[model samples]
Target: MKRITTDELRAMAGREGLIIQGCGGDLTELVNGINDMLTQEGILQNGDAFKDVSVFEYDGCTNLLFSMENVDLNIGKLAMWRLQSHETFGGTWLSDYLPNRLGVDMDQPPAQKEKPDCALIGQDGNIFNLIGIASRTLKENGLGEQAKEMRERIIASGSYDKALCIIGEYVNITSAEDAQEQDCGFEMGQSY
Candidate 1:
């Protein structure tokens, strides 16, 4: 329930991370579409249309000031992807893609499953939910090798919950190459 200033956010990010502005999905595209529609209807000037009115993040979580006015504008999700990675292509989360590829419905209430975004993986501790979903998706989609490896790592940790949190917080395996390059290891107590 704590909020940090933009200065704190900047300090946390430094120069090594990216702050993606939108969900990069239909929700964000809908905002752009609405802006275009408003412009065409003469409600908004051509140059005054919303470019990227996205949700903002404070310390990698969605800053919840939700409203009809701000919903479509402000940074939706925030994460630190690896340097030199393409923002849109590389920053996509596994939960975001699992719905479409696996025909899993994500429209259910948050109580059913955590929303793909980390901000919603909230105080109740739903990181394990995310890891379970991702683990299933990986196995279902023929990434059994990776799934097996992930399972082994989680089991070896001797604390399933902590292992899940570690993966949820530190792992960034957005792609196969990312998994190869960013192997699941962390120096204990390291911020990144």
Candidate 2:
């Protein structure tokens, strides 16, 4: 994936006819909190740089738009989200684009199967097994190709709603017991 800056992102939005100013899930809130924290810590003196910025986040992708004066503030916010525990499933968009804007070089992609950054974790701590919902989320986010891949995986997994699909992979349908017998260290958890 290519990395881009807020300025570059703005240009891309213009070229793609996308809305540059929008709301990303929790991105606005998190930016606000970080700005407030920075102000209190005496790291920022000219009010908050991100106060007037616009955000666009969805389906693990996040984008921001702010003035040059607050570039550092925006960079700080990106750092927090990109390098912190906020990226539970590695589904955040910070490292991919924002850091590149700040001249930061990120590591290369992993050699293993690249897991999808998004997942549906139920309130009961069970990862959702509903391929339909997953497919819909990807499709609605303009990731129609990813949605098709998800369906293919579901079909490959026998489309068993009760089957365990780890990291969104379509592989052997070995149960926890079977894994244990084979010493694969796999365990099944409750799903809601």
Candidate 3:
């Protein structure tokens, strides 16, 4: 993990060969997440000198490229996916990716005319899985080869899809509960 400035990221995009693309929300959040991870790892120094990270909109999402040298691609991918998921899930044409596994209609027709809330492009190639990162993190933190094996089991069991379904259910339940709470408050006020 290494904290890189916007200029450094751009230069890396130019030189090495890693690509990071995000659609919707603030790109600074993504940069900060990476920087924070790096900083936690003691790879980044404290100060404004390294805070120049930024992302430029390209195609539909903001794209930033960097080198993958000494970087864990799995963690990076998960971080991006989780962030975008938080931002765009439940929006039109931006439903959870996991529901697709359950034969749910997650994809919109090209002629439908609604833009997705978020889209991600990975230059390292499209084997997107946040679980992969979790597995890798486990291994990195001392689970060793067993961590890798468990990650494979998760992928095989379609944990990613199940995770998405669970997340959607949680969000729906939470929203409903919040609405009920608000209605209850309103009724109490009226009674008073």
Candidate 4:
């Protein structure tokens, strides 16, 4: 298998309209996961492995995107695996099991019962996006109040960067309304 640099990954993200954040890891595991899915489906010759993986930097975080062309499966299991493995929440054994258990043939045309092409990942790895696991962590660590305050602060900041900083630090605040106002140039709901 070959490895591609973060810059290459970023270029692909630009072309594909995907946003990636946070530090990137070896990505080999993610690649392998996809290869496994593809092998099981008999898309390529069995035992074929990923040839390239890459990461990119965006905003304040790094993003990863890779391609394993000539993949046997119809829709591309590597893409599916990367999405499932990287998402911050809702990726359970059931989620993984259901796709394989249903035995939907990748080569066959889409059927009513077949799983759809999809990719699921967290928006910011924040509590709101990961309520199930984050809530439990907050409760267990006695951070309920802190978590609530941080949420408010983030909403109030109206500055994506500020909110991201606070969320990154897991900081607490009284209210988002109290955050100092700043002109982010873009109107509300505008993409950054």
Q: Give the candidate number with the greatest lDDT.
A: 2
- Tens digit of lDDT per residue, candidate 1, span 106-132? 554322122122222332345456566
Every model's TM-score: 0.22, 0.26, 0.23, 0.28
Which residue pairs show collisions in model 4?
A: 6-55, 43-72, 44-72, 152-176, 156-176
* Candidate 4 Cα misplacement greater than 4 A, ranges: 1-23, 37-45, 76-192
Clashing pairs in 2: 24-57
The models' CA-based lDDT, in order, is 0.40, 0.42, 0.38, 0.41
Q: What ranking emerges by TM-score with the best candidate at the front?
A: 4, 2, 3, 1
Per-residue CA lDDT of model 4 for 43-140, tens digit only, reads 44656654533444444554443343333344454345436655652122222322343343334543222111111132245544533343344433
Native-structure RMSD, model 1:
18.6
**Candidate 1 CA-lDDT value:** 0.40
Comparison by lDDT, 3 against 4, better one: 4
Measured with C-alpha atoms, the lDDT of residue 134 in candidate 1 is: 62
Tell me the RMSD of model 4 versus the true structure.
19.8
Candidate order by lDDT, decreasing, is 2, 4, 1, 3
Tens-place lDDT digits, model 2, residues 1-192: 122344444232211111222334566565566567556655455574444344555334565543332234444544454355343424234334433434433443312323333434431323334555555545434344556666666557654553346324523222335535345444446333
Off by over 4 Å in 1: 1-128, 160-162, 165-192
